[model samples]
Target: MDTVITVTGEQSANDLGVTLPHEHLIIDASIWVPDGPELTAIQRRKLEESVSMENLWWLAAYGRQPKWNSLDNRRLDDVETAKREAMRFVAEGGETLVDVTPMSPGLGRDPGALKRIANHTGLNVVAGTGHYVRHAHPPRIDDQSASEIADEMVGDIVDGIDGTGVRAGVIGEIGATNGFSDHPNEKTVFRAAAIAQQRTGAPITIHPPVHYKEGHDVLDVLEEAGANLTNVILGHLDGAMELDNASAYYDSLAERGVSLEFDTFGRIGYIASEDVCFPLDETRIRELRRLFDKGYGDQLLVSHDICKKNQLTKYAGHGYDYILRDIVPRLRRREFSETEITSLLVDNPARALTIEE
Candidate 1:
């Protein structure tokens, strides 16, 4: 029998309703900051940089603005506020949310925190395990062998994270930069995550680097490590998933049975390129349509990768309910049937997150 694990406990896959495939309950992606913390406002002023191609990619891809003090808004560590967000999601009909927080300073996913949110909001929150992007990795990561890393994550699945008794339900949102863009120790984590997946039957999710691409290289690595592509999902397909460049990557992923996640919905300020704006509400639907047209609907999933405080309703974002509230209605307008929406919201997630035997 198929089962979906949550922080609260195991539940029938049938009960996993309105699932958000990738999101962060409480996190801080400070590793994403350019030049690290050393490049502060004072240093920035001395550098006298206006806007360069280096900084544009951040706005173009991750939705980070050009404000002088934008870095301060990078955290969402408040548990009480997170509880309120989860409650709002539940009230708006959100049932299950995959918290893809990896291990990081002031960031990453903690199963214990997830459990607290699950208990308070009554929403089924699936917890994450495994290391994050290269920049956020622990000092021990460079020293840990692939098998060693796999063992740690296997412990997370079999036992629990931090002895809190909250077993992780998924293996990643494992960090990769730009389709395996060599983040110092990225390949090690990728291989270990693959081993852990085969060891534990937990699904894996990938968080690509800022500069997105075909993601074929990283997928190749995972496949080489014996990962089941169907049990794996390639997330943040927004800017990098363009067909014009490689054109064959999407079909390749679909043909290989890997799922594509258009999870960052409702973030409209960012632009993809001169031709398109990323996190653009309409572009998501358009891209989603392209996927469906290509017969990859069954392998598709969607969510809002809401990791910033500004994205919350208290801070005036669409909140956790934006997808079902706004995006789905737009899909309906675009001639997507109830069946299609159900596949995106309900069926695909159950398949994506289920602990396969």
Candidate 2:
């Protein structure tokens, strides 16, 4: 049987149950959250406010404003907090979670922390390898060739990350922005991730910029690098619902043999920077039903993509179990059969994470 690498160790791929293909437990993606304009004294204080029931709505409601979307809100650094939140999913029948936080100092991918979470919660935690978007990448990246980057990532996959002996099961949540026009470094990372994926046969999951029809653009780069499409997953497809001819766009993407992850399950709001508004969960469910009807059900995956502190139940947001505790019932009410749901939450993730030997 093919094995899937987790933070603790390797496991039989078939043993990975009800997996969330996209999530972040111990991450600091604050680098991705852009700095806001000059802040007033009072505004700065509000931005630094600890997430609470009184301010949770304000945090979510002002998501469009970078100042209001505080850097403090974007980070999940507390191991115990992550464990407590993740255990909620374990109680709700989740067996595995893929923490696709990109491997970089700026993003702070902590393999040791992941190991602790797995040990504590008994949640098989699969980590990723690769750099994020240009902003998060170190300055040395500009001097490094794609081959050198691939060498580092392949080492992480085959040997381990930062000498932790915790091999990465996935190659991404590799980041890109506005289809690589703004950040050429993303192209290099894409090529490097593709090379690493080809070397290890590990699945590559992409974090495409919100609302860009870069699905094929991204695949083209990977294909040029001889990456296997069967082992690729493009994340945040829920953000594509607003595109013109969205269903047909999905049909073309499905034909390429790459899985599409409709993550961002619980987030609903506007993003001013991208001018993209996250659709309601009902809209995502409706789009999912449409995709299923078009026979693309097998190509689908789902997750809450919980990375922010406000997203934790401790802050009055939907916790890690949102999909199981809420979305599953909603899907059932929408007439989605158990088999389809199982494929989304279980079989697809197992297959996606399995190393090709």
Backbone Cα, N, C clashes tallied per candidate: 8, 0
The candidate 2 region of ten consecutive residues with least summed lDDT is 32-41
Top-scoring candidate (TM-score): 2
Against the hidden reference, what TM-scores do the models get? 0.88, 0.96
Q: Which candidate is the best by lDDT?
A: 2
Following a full C-alpha superposition, what root-mean-square deviation does model 2 have from the true structure? 1.6
lDDT for 96 in candidate 2 is 99
User: How far in Å is the alpha carbon of 299 misplaced in model 1?
Assistant: 0.5
Model 2 TM-score is: 0.96
Which portions of model 2 show Cα errors greater than 4 Å?
36-43
Candidate 2: residue 218 lDDT (0-100): 82
- How do the residues 236-327 of candidate 1 rate in per-residue lDDT, one tens digit apiece? 77655443553365667678888888877876654323344354678678778888988989999898899876677876577888998888
Residues 1-357 of candidate 2: C-alpha lDDT, one tens digit per residue? 889999888999999999999999988867755445677675677766766677777887884466666677888999999999999999999999999997877787999999999999999999998988777888889889889999999999899999989889899888887747556678888999988887888899999876878888888888898899889999998888877888788889999999989999998877775677788999999988988899988889999889888889998789999999999999899899999999989988888888887
Q: Score each candidate by Cα lDDT.
A: 0.78, 0.87
Q: For candidate 1, what is the lDDT? A: 0.78
TM-score, cand. 1: 0.88
